[model samples]
Target: MATKTRVPQTIDAYLAGVPDPAAKKTLTALRAQLKKLLPKATESISYQMPTFKVDGSAVAGFAFFKHHCGYYPFSGSVVPALAAELDGYVTSKSGVTFPPDQPLPAKLVKKLVQTRLAEIGTRAKKLAAAKKTLITERITDAAVKEATGHDWKAWMRVLDKAGAAGLPHKQLVTLVGRDVESGWWRQSIAVAYEQARGKRVVGETATTGFQVGVVRTLPMTAPQLWTWLTTQPERWLGPGATLNAEVGGSYVAPRRRGNPGVRGEIRVVKPGKRLRMTWQPDGWTKPATLQLTVMPKAKGASLHVHMEKLPDADVREAMRERWSKVLAQAF
Candidate 1:
């Protein structure tokens, strides 16, 4: 009689067939890291891999391959945010790979799990808010004019004259308040101005100061574009481009061929759509903010690069030129 074959049905059973003792050990360690970070999350088999769930949503998963062990956040957002620390490791849009001989660091794994949990919380809040505020009609020029005593174009011109684009959030609000008496109308005007200028959202201010760069329709989807921006920035920015795409994560773009490079921290990351980071170019005393937004177009995607709070006009113009070349190379 032929020997019976073992088929794994659970996480423990799945690990039983890992063959290599070292690989099995690594997988077990990774599992423990996830469990420690997500104490309340339940374990199950998902997509044929060991998965951890919170509130019935798949938060993370891990698998073993012939040469590598993989950790999947189940969302494309986490990989990019942890890009810098993941150097020398294989990574994809939604997962990271470690060699069977080398397991992921406990601290790094903890951070990844924490970041995903925070993202889940943020998305839940946004969904709840979306449900509460349902706008039946589109906001139009006529509506804005009727509500604020000025047409959209007129308000835009007023903002331009006031140099609102370069102003910090608090100052910009004060500037708008000067022209608009009603508090609600002031906020409305602020949002309108920001939108007209292609800014991200209201309450986003330039701490160090504002420069803008733009690259029109490139033949790529938003996710592909995001990969280009975060995965291999050195291809466009400089020789050494290391980016950690999370809030408070660090970035370093070393100078190349006499061109200046930048170093700073990431402030915001909305996967596939937006990324905002501080920009402190080589030799700069104070840092500025850089924001990249990807919008899906008919053919491909449009990328908007905004740098704010530079020291002077010269620095801003120089950065604008550098970014223009960078985008040209990128596309």
Candidate 2:
């Protein structure tokens, strides 16, 4: 009969008790991978396992046990797209378990981490986007106070008028279903504006110029991700010069003896949480803003990126698709 022991609090304690060498090696490799993924994560012993903190909170962790090695990214169930990939893994509310004798699925583990990280990045971007909405909410509230004098029914009428204009079926489900309380109301404002206008609701952009704004989140920590973004420019930018992460830094991409400078002022640099800089190439007419924001979840961080000042709707849509491709490659 198997005896159930109380959960341990530190990774050292769990490792000490586990007698399986394979499990130990698995744990070691996992730790190394996680370190590579999130170098900025602060380490500690919690629940008798290794826990990593991102942006001051625990985002993920690992543990060694008698039967299996456990890897947990606190918020993972929401990632439906990965369900097929994680099909064979043994999962629970807190984590997934990999057996000792069987070969550890390195790719799957990395995917899990990346997915969690992307979620965090999405959250961070939403928070930044939410701030923009908050201001609108305040204005709307003030307008209501002035016009209706606290009449709730009048507000409903205003909302109805707005909803009639915009057919926001998909966006509403995406934002509201995610429980973005702060941004939802403002979406209504967008809807209202759309309803009031007779403009056509066209799809994503088409110009290749916008394709340069590729945004993605990695499971790795800010330092690790930044290293890839800066050091691995050749992999993505097709022979880019280099990037310096400072106030007056510049990035130059050289293609066939011609050096094009991607230079701008670093707007918001909040260490590991956010980085926004101006990006203007020598030949381009408009200046673009490149923004990266990291949001932490239970076990990882999300990365939200935006390349603003795109020329037209078609270009913007193309940029969005480009970002998706970049994300798949990097994250």
Q: Which candidate number maximizes lDDT?
A: 1
TM-score of 1: 0.41
Q: Write the per-residue lDDT of candidate 2 for residues 1-331, one digit (tens) a residue.
A: 5433444455556566668988877787777777888889877764335777677545667765546776666552423456677688775434566787664577877787777677667767764664454333455666644543533344446545545334444553343334334455445444433323422122212222232344344687666665666567554443444666565665554532222445566666676666777767567676777787766554455567677656544334334433443454464
Where model 1 places Cα greater than 4 Å from the true spot, the runs are: 1-7, 136-331
Among all candidates shown, the one with the greatest TM-score: 1
Look at candidate 2 and tell me the lDDT of residue 33. 78
| Candidate 2 whole-model C-alpha lDDT, 0 to 1 | 0.56
The sequence of per-residue lDDT tens digits that candidate 1 reaches over residues 223-329 is 88888878877665566578877888888976543346679888898988998988887788678888889999888898888878766433444455455445644
Question: After superposition, which runs of candidate 2 have C-alpha atoms over 4 Å from their true positions?
Answer: 1-13, 78-80, 135-145, 148-331
How accurate locally, in lDDT, is each candidate? 0.72, 0.56
